[model samples]
Target: MHDGIVVYPTDTLYGLGGDALSDEAIMKVFEAKGREYHKPISIAVSDPDMIRAVACVDELAEEFIDQFLPGPVTVILPARTILSSWLTAGTKKIGIRYPNHEIALELISRFDSPITATSANLSGGPDPVSLDLCTVPYDCAINAGPLSGIPSTVVDLELREIIRAGAEIDAVAAFLAQWS
Candidate 1:
């Protein structure tokens, strides 16, 4: 991401992202994908601490996160850190992930900051499973074979609603219900 945006493999699909903390880098990802800055982008974090650094997780949100993360799920939480509106896209919430893929997690673990976690594809285009299918301009790409093409399940825990039922929604709700 230092050089520019990179297309990396995640548990769900290939994602186009850069330094999540760098507004300039984030903008480059936006430009590369022809994406508007007003659209919020998700982030890939390395660990629980990393998740806490960027988002404010309440007790209810924490239960779902503790039970269903490091898997194929994108949990949207209130933004706690002061990041550019470009990252959160004017919304007070940020979608966060801790992808189960080792490569994805290691990249963020080493970088010591979140990385953009939006799918690697053109704006309004289908999500790419293979690096070869990506149309965005990226400085680097790490391919790990083909993905299932099913995006992660997206949940807005603050609202206790399922935004996108990609993977493991019922279990997530059931788990959260335990604490609810």
Candidate 2:
């Protein structure tokens, strides 16, 4: 699915991804999910260097990432110039995920580029835990049975705040608290 959207598995739930830097691909992801342009999408990075390529990571952010990456945390960081405004959803900050699942990791690593990490479901719909539960139109689908059915906990390091509470909130909170 070159320059197109693909439905794949994540640690928490099924997700849809495309080229993070391609506005066209980003549009397809938004269109497929019925997501509004104003709603920002997170990106999945194959490795730590990929994260550095897209975002400005500070000591706190790096520490947090090191502590719980490749797990279930979405760390929001200051956007770098390389990412398109569409990927950032007109914001200066972007959410990032380093999935723990091997299938998801392999997909991103093999893709050799960052891909969109938005949940694969209609906008405002329940997040899908299984591939069949995802109704969004994607060029390819990778089923890995069911997921944890929980969403990733989102942390905005710049604000030193927890944006969304999810499966790993407690652990993230405890880790971030040490920095304060």
Best by TM-score: 2
Task: Report the CA-based lDDT of candidate 1 relative to the real structure.
Answer: 0.86
Per-candidate TM-scores read: 0.94, 0.97
Q: Clashing pairs in model 1?
A: none
- Model 1 Cα lDDT, one tens digit per residue, 1-180: 573787888888999879988888998888888988789999899898888888997887777778888999999999975666788888889999899999898888888889999988999887798888898988888889998788899988888788888888789767767655
Kindly give the stretch of ten consecutive residues in candidate 1 with the minimal lDDT sum.
Answer: 171-180
For every candidate structure, what is the RMSD over all alpha carbons to the true structure, in angstroms? 1.4, 0.8
Q: Which stretches of candidate 1 lie over 4 Å from their true place?
A: 176-180
**Predicted candidate 1: what Cα RMSD to the true structure?**
1.4
The backbone clash count of each candidate, in order, is 0, 0
Candidate 2 segments whose C-alpha is farther than 4 A from its true place: none
Question: For candidate 2, lDDT tens digit of each residue in 1-180?
Answer: 558888899999998989998888998999998888898999999889999999999898788878899789899999999998988878899999999989889998898889999999999888899988898998989989989999999999998889999978989889878877
